[model samples]
Target: MAESTDPNPAAPVPGLPERILLGAAYYTEYQPYERLEADLDLMAAGGFGVIRVGESVWSTWEPRDGVFDLDWLQPVLDGAHARGIAVVVGTPTYAVPPWLRKTYPETTAHSATGVEIPYGMRQDVDYSHPTFRYLAERVVRKIVGRYADHPAVIGWQVDNEPGHKIFYNPQVFAGFVEHLKDTYGTVDELNRRWGLTYWSHRIADWSELWTPDGNSTPSYDLAWRRYQATLGHDLIRWQTDLVRSLVPADQFVTTCIALGQQGQDITVIGEPLDVAGANLYYATQDGLELPGAQGLEGGLASFFVPWSGPAYLSLQADTARGTRQAPFLVTETNATSIGGTADNFPAYDGQWRQTAWHMVARGARLLNYWHWHTLHYGAETYWGGILGHSLEPGRTYAELSRVANELTAATDALAGLEPVSDVGVLVGAESRWAMECMGPLAGPAHSWMGDPGSYDRILAAFYRGLFDAGLAADIVSPGQLADVGPGLPDDAAAAALVARWRVLVVPGLYIADDATLDLLRRYAEAGGHLVLTPRTGYADADAVVRSTVAPGVLRGAAGVHYLEYTNLVHPVPVTGAGWTGAGTAWADGLLVDDAEVLAGYDHPHLGQFAAVTTRVAGAGRVTTVGTVPDRELAGHLARYLARTSLPVDPWRDARPETVTVTAAVNAAGERLRFVHNWSWEPATYRLPAAVRDVLDDVALAAGELLALGPWDVRVLRETP
Candidate 1:
């Protein structure tokens, strides 16, 4: 557990951004004060705030551990503070001082396979080690104590993403075993639940247990799912707790969770920290090529919906595979990744403008561009940065600045507005972890599924249905209900879909959290009309709770007694609501009590819950689609959204697949629609009349057809 402390006072709350809050990180190590000062001039003019001051200058900061240096950095940070800008100082744990590593060789860890490694991976350190913790705490206290009150210090970034190269630390074994015990209480219980006796992996005592070695089952195999997420999360949590003591409560302490797949368990990782910040790089040449966790839509939904608090785009890298080979950084906004680089220039000013607004609308509290200036490699090679090697104010700089100025002016309106959504998507980090583990590439589970597209197919199809229907949504993770202002006031009644999203598109969720389960029980009992699929409230986060038996928890609220059976198929010629075609679907059968089956198997042998509905919880309706919905079921989804009074006027005229949409409702019950088109070609369209496209100043009249160019977006606003 971390000791409670107050963080540094951040910069003035410059109101809610009408557009996205634009910022750029300044890498001061590569340049002198003069260059930084010159760059600061452009930064201020471009309306940039919040510079991520890094601790990478170990050689510059300390000649030795105790001897700290701030001579070079003082002026830049102080100057920025004087100019009313915020500085998010980074604690440099990524690059350990060579002396420290050489002196304490143990700092370099031994892998699970038992190999003594040297200084080859960057940002690699075992979090389970007490010695490393001591050093990290000492260094953090020193830096944070010194600068906690500094006017410029608004946030403290605790170590870059934890992975040094495949977060394969020896700590995994210790941490995982410990987490399993803490969660399951007894080794015998763990053994029984995991069905380990069958595999000859049964445990006689907790001490005998350990994370499986180099070659073993994936950590997510339903039996070990909770233990796996908890294990990965525990390591991250331990490090964050150490940081909490040094930083203040006001000065948010956060770490970036990059490298999605095996390296970091983001959901569990942030449990010990304050800010759930993410480093999102859309369509970039970045590495870490994991299938289940990559792609633009997946990345956005994964990060945005899960963290139930204010968010910051921590480190968005800017780069291009062009002749000049430059990347944009230091600041966000402006045109696309095109500037001094040849063939990669901004296509149109308006496109970037809309992108900025769309991100803000989605839910970015602060957006930091990757690098402010391209660092001079001291004659090695030039890389990613907003400004090129010449240090000229590239075309993007001016354009970005212009957008910043625009956002600054509009912050007043933006701050007053809140998001509105009716479509509900359940995000389960543990389930995602399970899915990843189940995949063939790495980790656990043995499945012959040719590709690992099952997860994406289901999630993306739902996203598209919402878009075509023009219903924005407040996507929720299992434990995120408390995030939407407490007490669920009347004004916010429409937006009050916590456990299950209010009433619209309550997706048949998998692997639920206790909080989510309890919330849904309360919501359903309160008169919410809900549709339940086969697996509603089936498995807990651990992928445990196999069969929902009588007197067993979660069976009552879900209103279904799910029987354990596998290999169920979707009913063909499925014609329920608007779905009437051959579509493949995963099925789960349950004995219905209070719920009515809307669509299901008409055959004798195949008894699956295709679709069902029940009116429960505050005039809310629940519809659970039995299996992963196929793309052809979009019309059925649309019909459900319409029947439930979900706002379907936003992009209703547009093709169901052209774009994706999610909606939200503010305190005033005003519907705010977020439309995203992730295609190569541009799209053009007239947004629905109920809402206004404040971005391009377009009004969508009902029944009016408009063609949204490729990759275009429109925020349709309406009233509930």
Candidate 2:
């Protein structure tokens, strides 16, 4: 086996390098056979330390059923090992070979409508099919057993992002039925929980149940999502276990959580991996509001705006880190533009550098672009890389080389660095799925007319609020706070976790179980501050509305109850808490009990009820927002809570659109601050304290005004 780059290689099985890793996805089998030596020379010149291969080429490895062609990969591995470059191998099960597919047509994934998906795209096979299992096992065992002893192999990626598709074949349907039987133990219990009596949709027999595709019932839809997530989790865990058994203890096993899209439960699939890895691509074009402009929503739009990139990247990074309680790897990111567009935008000079450093700031241990060289032919042919299609060094390669050199020189400055945040934003797939069933509050699913008012949009706005307030925060998941059972006392752990953050904000948490509710209660009772926006705790884990009251289970903690709510077509005036602004979308007519009114509607009739209320549950406090707060008001509430309810002093003068700041600390007790100018115009920023720039070793006095050009970033090391 290969040794690590560290001097003390016996320290432990490190997940990634202590120092940052810079590399690209290299392919030796694709086309226009690259001169291996020349490419390696260019990579070495760029100061790359690793290359990821063997991910997208299962057919290349096994052209026929039993014929394993392993000789072609050895030269690539040996050459990289000779040049001191580590390799991360992958089990190529994502793309089924043509021979296997033609032989077993039943292995193809079927849609919810019972239409089979053809075999052109990757991951089109039914993962749970018996035929697929037998073939995949043979391929994975052979590849892992063959390369387990390769000196250059340092890591293994289980499969390329395992949660992209949903399968609905006969096997999957039977599995779902079996899963329901196991969960509820009886058809009667399932019928009762799903409220089948509402429309005479009760289940009489196990086979009578249909897939929840066209169903509008929230409970059935939620169960379907849960079942789908279970499948993904099991599949990934199985692959991870197989790889772990084959590889040595020193080599890490992981899979990339691609794009932060929540088709699969991230927390579940990530539980079995050693390190959480993800692929991210942000907008390279200037002034592109992608989520709104490109129809991508719910934290999927990276680089929508200047601050949007950092906000979304931080969200995904925090989600990954929270999954494993450790730093993660950027296994796949854009070398240039991404996607299957005819003409995609390119990363301008300094843009890729900014994106890379921002990801590191948010806690990425390794950074590798998707592919080394742009493809000459494929569906992703237009997706450019560092080397253009001509196999020559281009502008991207030049910029990447500069970034590589700088990272190599200043590696010591970033050693043992970790992000420290004083705020946590709780999110989950259950809530997203629940909202999807209810559809967007803006009426039709396809209409963006009310795009300003959807469940995910509101949550994204809350996250953007924290970003605009210059408060560092982590996007926490409900699974992170879930109970580990067996008398583990999840309440204590949940309290302690929330105690680390000054504020815990739950945005649009529609489906919350009792355990989660109790955890939130324990947090508030133990002197932790929390903020709950609209639609939190309205339904249970089964997606059934609670009969007690609106915001059930959390009403006691919120110190208020509401029975009625309305969707506003236009903005309504709101006044309280030393701020006056208009609220939009929905308004809950709350009945205040022990809670103090923080804000109230300016309407004559609705003004009687509280718009926002703050209550002290025990030693801690909880604030409930009755309506959707706009950007300005959201920032106002964040500042108000941080200043009055928490012990953090948020950064001053960091504007939402123009200037942004993120800070972290190293093991040596030194603080590293990233101050960015996201605007396209020159701006001046006054230093918060006297500090030295780690990049250039320049010292500046406290309150010294520094002028920054467009898209400029300064890495400052706080000096006492």
Candidate 3:
């Protein structure tokens, strides 16, 4: 596959350093005692280069409405600048102040119609409300105006994680109606498109549309979700535009997006900002282990986002990069532990370094922890930070210090790094929303309710497969593919996409337009491996099921039809040419017509249908996986796909069981490789070619064995 520069250019921030920045979120106001100078000194000593401040404490920024106390943070900025550490000033908007909340009860967001979300927690206000926006603008200007010219300020984070809830406030519902009118043009058109004739739901006027509290209509739910996402986008764009007007040109603006948040889409929300920023918090310790770590079951219950060992981290990083198809900043990650009390699982020795380098390898430009010091009293009191409750540096701090030093040492090689991808996994926010509305998979304990993470579960199965098979993949968006223009008959665009991504793996693309489905077919015909999994092309963009055969428009190219599918209550054993594994959660009884059977169910009844099938369409091939494959089967499929589609590389030869190697190319036209050992047992791999160790500054010859300690990583650069 060919490598290309990032589609998005770097932000024109001249004062910002051209290197990977490392630090933590510093909240001096939250400190129990006066420790601004002490914290700055400690950060400098630990090789910290950037610190994100002032995002979480809105009440502290302004003690009351129209009463600004912006001078308090002057000392923190001055101290950071004196120590040569750059700062990212944050606008305190996500967390509303107590005074504002009490005075403007009308601004409170409703979780459901007429049911207001109780105050106390952050992000409870209806940000789209005029009152909230007016108050927010005042504090934002007060903060940014005071520190816009500070030499230490390199960037501005407009808000903390922006999308926490889907606002059900009355005004928000009114806006939703307007959004629908703008989209569909008329109530008649909406009724026809959404098939509202069912259950006598067709409305004569837009006012008859009911609230989302008890709506069972998929079309309405999908639109509501999309509108909510746009609200998040608008909020970010509004804040960014406001900040841009006040801050100097050298200061970039962004919002820290929680990728798995319900109310927003990262791909759309990051557009108005200069660069994409995300908060990546994963399960540490055994959760970072590979091979032995089973798939999504490891951390799915505790977190909203699906976590499956190293693949989870990779998926999150790839998602961030996909937001802008450029290097993104990790605004908040694990410093010690990542959750509330009873959820303490700090990294084991080298895991922090491993996680840090893995993110960098996937195109992260900055890695800032969630916090500097763990709070003594608050909602997140047990969300551990660099310093513990005792205010002393310990193992987490020391490990992160090592990570900081390594990042500093390899800054030149790591700058402007674009991760090399052999496969593209199509990720659609619309499809995700649709899947959430009418989930395909059963919830935990085989409950009657649908799993909200059904989309992620299917996506992660294939993604984890790629990770386990040691292949680098990109999480691509439908908008990115649509931007390539129509495919297939337009051979130029089709061939361009094929050249860019050798294999395109689409797992849960349940809601796609006709153009996108046709594009995938054309892509396959134009010499690209199109891997289709369950729930793909089943519904249109509006979440309406297609009347045609399942897999919709691509059925001809896929060479198979699935008129019937069942939610698997137990794992169904599957056997292929040489591998043995089982299908879990879902199974589509794929009746093949002209395709070659690659795998079949081992069950006596289900054996009548193929579990997997592939066929040639022009010069390329299309593979259809009828069920959600287990880790083993997914890995087998991934390895087979990689071998068939991607060119052979030396890194793929003699790979160790516990090791993963990801490659990238920097702007300087240098090839960089990240080799990681996820096991407690030490591992070794022979050098593929002559290379220099980026972190160690040592040279090694071809065929030399490179030894890695337990939970270790080695950054290498290929030399001619």
C-alpha lDDT of candidate 3 relative to the true structure: 0.87
Per-candidate TM-score against the hidden true structure: 0.72, 0.91, 0.97
Q: Which predicted model would earn the best TM-score?
A: 3
lDDT score for residue 232 of model 2: 73
Which residue window of length 10 is worst by lDDT in model 1?
318-327
Model 3 alpha-carbon miss at residue 402, Å? 1.8
lDDT of 2: 0.75
Ranking by lDDT: 3, 2, 1
lDDT for residue 144 in candidate 3, whole number 0-100: 82
Residue 225 of model 2: what lDDT?
79
Tens digit of per-residue lDDT, candidate 2, span 1-720: 110011111222344666687889999787587588888888887888788999889898899988898777888888888887888998898898889888889888887657888778898888878788788888899889988889888899988878677777888878888988999998899999989888888989998897756676779878887887787787789899988988888899888777434458776677788887887766565522212221223232233222344556556666666665566788988787676544466766666777777777777778888778988888888777878888888888887777777777768888766776767788878888778677335644445334323666667667766766777676667876553222446656655655465578999888898878888877887777878888888888899988878777678888998988887777788888586666777888898978999889888878988888989878788999888876667777877777766554334543435676777776685888887766567678778788898889999888787666666777888899
- The deviation in Å at residue 180 for candidate 2 is 0.9
Best of the candidates, lDDT: 3
Question: Model 2: runs farther than 4 Å from truth?
Answer: 1-15, 259-263, 287-309, 443-453, 482-495, 602-609, 648-657
TM-score of 3: 0.97
Per-model C-alpha lDDT, please?
0.50, 0.75, 0.87
lDDT of 1 by residue, 1-720 (tens): 111011111132222223345777677677644676677777887787667776565545655766777566778888887776778787776667776677666666655445655664455555446776676666667677777778788776777655434333556555656666677898777776666666687779877665444324433254344444453455456656665666666666666555343544443465555545555443221111111121223222223222110111111211010001111112233223322223232324333444555555554556676667665663212334567667787765766676677667655445434343344455445555455444212112436631243443445555544443444444445554444436765334334543234353434355665666666555545444444443445556565554547213545554555554334244344545545433344555545656555555555544454344343444444455555444445446655656554333434545444455544333344556666554545655544545556445566665565555544555566532
